[model samples]
Target: MLRTLSIRDVVLIDRLDLTFGIGLGVFTGETGAGKSILLDSLGLALGARAEARLVRGGAAQAVVSAEFDLPQEHSVLDMLAEHGIAVGRDEPLVLRRVLAGDGRSRGYINDQAVSVSLLRRIGDELVEIHGQFDNQRLLNTSVHRVLLDAYGGHGDLLAAVGAAHRDWRAAVDARKRAVDALEEARRDEEFLRHALGELDDIAPEPGEESELSRQRQGMMNGEKLLEAMNQAAKDLGQGRGVERMLRDAVRALEPMVEKTEGALKAVLEPLELAQENISEALLQLERASQRVDLDPNHLEQLEERLFALRALARKHNVTVDDLAVLRETIAARLAEVDDGDAGVRKLTHAQAAARKAYEDAAAALSAARVAAADTLSHAVMAELAPLRLGAARFSVIVAGGGDADAWGEGGWDRIAFEVATNPGAPPGPLGKIASGGELSRFMLALKVVLSKADPVPTLIFDEVDSGIGGAAAAAVGQRLARMADEVQVLVVTHSPQVAARGENHWRVSKSAAPEGVRTRVEELSRADRQEEIARMLAGERVTDEARAAADSLLQGTES
Candidate 1:
């Protein structure tokens, strides 16, 4: 519910502040007294398009702010929270907009700066303005289905349809992915099998290349190594030449030892030690030469193994170390190819089940909508007679069963509020068939019937009593009052009956000021309200009989 509106430098409304309360409030003024300016200010605060002309002449900017009190569970609270704008449960939601003289604008919510689009979205949720020229919400066929569902209280059914739609879409995506994988694997089937065959044939092992290279290096120099060992052995008396000479010298020294006494004893000991060392050296050389391998056939075999491993590595574009891993990967791809058909078939079955679920949920929602449409049409028709629309016909057309392209999360139903202005006339869209006055009355009747279901907390009707008077105008006022029991209602009316029906009344008038003409609104007292209504009934002059009639209308509403 809107609690207050503040306007600054907005056209004729130079600086105006007004407070509002629950139930019906009426703004009554003579022609050109700036009632429209009041609404424009409210619109500006509600994120309407900012125009340079809307800014008062010679003023730098125009500002308007609207404050509202919303329920704790209102969807707008969640929306604000999503945008990082926190609103406490008891805190009022304030939306303000400033329009510069150059047509630039800024919007704020709860004193926090926000984009105009966001402000507009929240404004849409909080207030609905219905006039002869501003019936977009009821006229737009796109929102008709949503309005019908809301009226029918189909929250659970809508949720079910949404969930089913999501599940069906997910299943479709999964099946498409599986089918794509199967097709790709089939295209590469022959290549995979052939590559696996080559890798299996070679059967390369990890580190085999390095081990083979090491053995090949040793074998490549085998002949040179053996020749050097043989030469060293020959130099160290391999044929027993040094050992034989040493033993012969030792024997001669031993025989002369007795004759030479002590001198011969020292020489004999040294000759025996030299002969022992030469014998051990000859044994070591013979053992070393025995282990040297000089066979060319073994070296050729080693080279063949090493080269084959390297050639296979280069052919696969992988090192010898990665050949084993590559073989495993190839085997896995081949396995997938062999099982691709079964995987795709399983996914296809799941997709079918998901589609069935979605169809069932959508069908149920559609059926419920058809039933609710009849009830809503009847309810709205019942309201038409009291508002001087007895000859008119109101209906809710729930159309379904289009092609798959027309299906949506909200089900397949196409709902519209259609009306026929005269008896036997073919019903057409609400906006196209009704005149200015008829459209406003039609909206009022709909609002009266759907008051409890409408989520908007406030409803503003401009020129709702455009052409109706006497009993018809009083009927319009009574219905507006009835709707106010559920939501806040504000009407800009010239009808005395409507003005007298308001729980609160304000008189809008234009006055000449020092600078220029300015528009002002005064909240009328009980006595003041009677005068305003009389002024509405008698025009420029308020007659005694008009005052008496206005008093009676006020009393009738009170009763």
Candidate 2:
């Protein structure tokens, strides 16, 4: 629902702010009283393109803000969230639009700046407006089937069909991709044979790259280790300096054993044993470092071996360990190419099944639409009679195509709404056949019937009743009142009867400012509304008769 609209320096609306309620709101005024200025300003707020001419003469820019109470699941709220605009669930979405005299425009949602296109997208979701000389949506044949379904309250079933259709299409697309891949692989059968043969010949293994490099290093340094080993051997057992020293010590200890007795003998024997053990360890270390190979040919071979592995790894753009995985994948692809027909057959079968499921769902929805169209046509016709279109013939036509092009949600056939103004004449398209007044009446009937199902939060009708009055006008007013129970309805009307039906009423008038003009709006009290209605009924005069008629009009509905 539109909670409020504020305008600043927009055409004749220098500054205006108005709060709204759930039920019907009527804006009434005489010619040149700026009723249309109000609508135009409101339109600018609802994402209409900016016009420099609409800017007040003294003002460099114009600004309009529309605040809407959004439902939890509204698509606009999702869009806002996606754009990083924070709006609480069930919170009012305060959309603001500003227009500069240079023709630049800006928009905002919940105080966060937004692009104009986004505002247009979000605005479209929140409000639906119909007007004279404008292309009203209800008259569009393309959407007639969906509208009929909505009128019949089949939104859930349509939603189910939509989900099923999307899933089916996705499956079909996946199968197509699989089949395409299989076909492409068949063209590479010979290449696969060659590549796999090469990989199989090489038989690369994980960890082989690091092992080869280490082996090459060890072989190159073999001579250096051998030279160091021989020198250490001469110092130990081969030279025998430590061994000679230990022999002298042992002889000295033997003499002490008799002189100092067993205590001195134990200490001397331990020192002699320690020297002998150290000499033996040095001999083992020297022997272990002996030159195993110092051949230049062996080192050359190791260098070549490491280079071969590195070259192959570079050619494959992979570390040697990843070659195995690459080879496996190639083998798989080659196998798939060899069994191309088998894979294609599987994919084709799956695609056929998915397409069949979507078709079946679409066919059922089409049947349901056919049934719903008949009932909807009858209901709308019933509504038309009270609006003085008793002679009009309304139609809901379902076009050709029994099953071939069946689709999701929207069903299998092309659908349209047709009408004939006079009995005996052939029924024609609604927009072409109906006059402005007839269009308004038709739209009003459609809205009343459709509002309960796929309802918009706010509805604005701009002088839709321009050519209707009397009992027909009364019917239009009554239906508008009834629709208010479902959604907020704002009517820019001239009919006294229509004015009387609104739970909330406002009078739109103009005031001249220093630079240009300004629009003013005020909610009317009971007495003021009575006078306004009477004034509307009688131009330039509110006689006793007009007052009495206005009283009767207001009294009859009591809305």
Candidate 3:
């Protein structure tokens, strides 16, 4: 439901604010009293195309905003959620639109910026406005099935159909992903075959690069370490070396100090230990020198292995280990294309299965819609009589053979609402066949039917009661009131009878403003409401009889 509308510097409206309430609320005014201006302001705020002309002459920008009280199940919630906009539970959604003199426009929802297209999409679910020559979603042939299902209470079936459609599409997408991948593989088949064969020939191992590098370095450095270790071993272990000289010296000193003291014994013990340690170290040095095989052939072999890994790395643009995986991948690609017919057959079978599933679900949904159409058409026809189109014939024509691709909300039926003013004439498109007033009545009749099914909490009719008065006007008013019971209804009307039928009324008037002209709206009290109706009845003047007639109209419930 639209809770409030605030306008600033938009066309003739300068700082106008309206707070709407439940039941039927009517806006009444004379010609050029800015009734149309109010609706235009609402439309602009609801994401209609922005126009520089709409900006007030002296103003740099115009702002129009509408706030709506939406429920959980309302379609607007999902749309807003899809855009990542937060809509608190039971919180009002404020949509603000601003247009600058330069023709730039901006929109916001709950203070969060939103694209105009997104705002427009969310707006469609929030409000359905029917005005002079303006047909809302009801005129769209696509939604006709959903309408029928609503009337037939086929919500469960519709959900199932939607789920099936999504699953089928998913399967098709999976198959396509593989096929696209396979096609890309096929493009590189020849090059990959050779590359895989090359890696197969070498078959380099992980860490082989660093391992071979260490071996090569060891072989290259063998010459420098070989001579040094051999010389040290010769000096330490050969005759006249440290071990033989130290042992002889200890023997000589020990004998000379044999009678002197135990100090001579300590020196002898240290010399003996040092000689033994040098002999053992000399043997280890000789062993290490022997391990350094200066065989140049081994060095060449290590160099060859290191260069092989590097060459392969450069050629494939990958490290040596990655070559293994690369070999496997290319081989798999070659295998896939090699088994070409097999893959194609698999994809073909999958597509066939998915298509069959989609077709079955679509067929079921289509049948349900056909059944729903019959029930909905009957329900809508019943609503039309009370709306004063009793003699006029109406039909919800569902043209069969709608493409399965086009099957969505209504299972692909080319639906059109047709009407005939009299029983004998053939029914044509409702919008073209009915007069402006008749179109409004037809829209009202459809809305009254749809309100019972759709989750939208408010319905606004901009001059829906136009070109209608007298008995027909009363009927329009009553229908609006009846529809209001299901959801709030705000009507901009000229009919006094329609004004009398409202549970609440707002009188719109234009006043001279500092800028130029401005439109203002206010709720009407009981006595003042009657006087406003009298003015509408008498036009520019209020008399005793007109006042009495307005009173009678107001109290028409007594009759």
Candidate 4:
């Protein structure tokens, strides 16, 4: 509900602040008294388009702010939370907009800067303005189904239908994927078999490629390595080699040690150690030469195996290390191809089951909608006679035949509200058949009937009561008063009968000031309200008769 609206430098509204409460509020004034200006200012605060022309003539900019008391579980608070804006239930949600004369504008929600689009989206949930020219959401055919379901209390059934639709779509997708896979497998059957055979023939093993390459390299350099090993062994083991000389020196030192005793004993020990190291070196060289592979045939064989492994890897478009894994995957796919028909059959059965579920849910939803249409049509018709639409008949049309192409989550039915203004006339769309005044009354009837289901916190009616008076006007006022019990109601009206029903009243008027023109609104006291209603009834001159009539209307409203 709108708690307050503040405006600054917006056209003739130099500065204005008005507080509202939880009931029907009416704003009334003479023609050209700036009632429209008041609504326009409220619109600006509700994220309507801002224009440089809206700024006061000499002012540089204009600003408008609207404060709303958001309930704890209201959708507006959910939207705010989604945007990371924390709005406590105890705090009023303030939306502020600034329009500069240079055609620039900025929007703020709870003091956090936001895009105008976001502000507009949030505003849509906070308030709704219904007038002849403004957008009338009730006229939209798309909302007709939602309104019907809401009235019918079919939320659970609708959810079930939606869930079933999703399940059906998922089943269809799974079947399609299975069919595509089968087709692809059939197309590549020969290639897959041939690749599998090739991999099986080669019988590649993990780590085999690196081991073969290393052995092949060793064999390729075998001759040079063998020659160097032989040379080393021959040099170390020959008769004139260091080992023979060391043994001869050891024998001579043994004789000298016998003559010199202890001094020659240390020299003989060093000679004996050198001879032992030479003998061990010869043994090592002999073992090393035995291990070398010098045969050219062995090298050729290793090269052939290594090259075959590499060529097979290239043919399959995989590295040698991946060849084994690819073989397993190919085998698995072939098995799937053999089982393809069974898989397809399973998926087909699942899809059919899903379709059946959806049809059952949709049929239930359609039946509920049909039942709701009858109840809603009767309710709306009941309101028409009181609003001076006695001859008119309201109808809720259900276009449901379960055609596949027209199926939707809401149901197979396309619901719309239609009207026939006279007897035996074929009912048509509400927008096409009814004049502006009639449409307003029709919408009013629907609103009064659906007040308990409406989620919007505030509703503004702009001159919707334009062409009715006396009992009809009073009926409209009475309906508006009843709607106020569920949601905030604001009406811009000229009828004294309607104005007299206001729980709170404000009179808008314009006057010439020294600077320029200015529009102002004053909340009326009980006596002032009586005079205002009298002025509305008597026009420029309020006679005693008009005052008495206003008094009677007020009494009727109070009672």
Off by over 4 Å in 1: 203-326
lDDT of 3 by residue, 1-559 (tens): 8889899988777678888888888899888888887878888888888879888778989999899887767777778888898788968899999899999999999899989998888788778788867867777765765677677787777677677667767777877877877788789888988888778888877778878887788888898888788777776767777888987897789776758766678777888888888878877887888899689988888787778878888898998768777778788888878886577778778777876766676677667767777766777788777667898887877675556666553344566677897879899877678888778788888887778887657788877777657887888888888889889898888888888988888898888867666777788899998999999899987998899999999999425
> Distance from true position, residue 88, model 1, in Å?
2.2
Report the C-alpha displacement of residue 394, candidate 1, in angstroms.
1.5
Q: Sort every candidate by TM-score, greatest first.
A: 4, 2, 1, 3
- Name the runs in model 4 displaced over 4 angstroms: 81-84, 235-288, 401-406
The list of candidate 2 runs beyond 4 A from truth reads 89-91, 139-146, 220-228, 238-308, 338-340, 398-415, 422-429, 510-519
TM-score of each: 0.83, 0.85, 0.82, 0.89
Model 1 over residues 312-393: C-alpha lDDT tens digits?
Answer: 7798899988988989987887777788788888889999999899899999999999999999999999999988999999
Q: Runs in model 3 with CA error above 4 Å?
A: 7-16, 49-65, 73-87, 97-122, 142-154, 180-198, 246-277, 296-309, 334-344, 386-393, 397-432, 509-522, 534-549, 556-559
Please give the clash total of every predicted structure, in order.
0, 1, 0, 0
- Worst lDDT run of 10 residues, candidate 3, spans 404-413
RMSD, every candidate, angstroms: 7.5, 3.8, 4.2, 3.7
Residue-by-residue lDDT tens digits, candidate 4, 1-559: 9999999999898999999999999999988988888777778877888778889899999999999998669888888888999987599899999999997999999899998988988988888888876667789898888889989999999999999998998999999999998888888989999999988998889999999999988888888898998888877767788988998888777777767857988778878887898788788888988999888888888888889989999988899989999999888888779998999999999999998999999989999999999999999999999899999999999988656867767768989999999989999998999888898899999999988777778999887788899889989999999999999999999998889889999999998999888898999999999999999999888999999999999998898
Model 1 score (lDDT): 0.89
- Worst 10-residue lDDT window for candidate 1 reads 232-241
Leading candidate by lDDT: 4
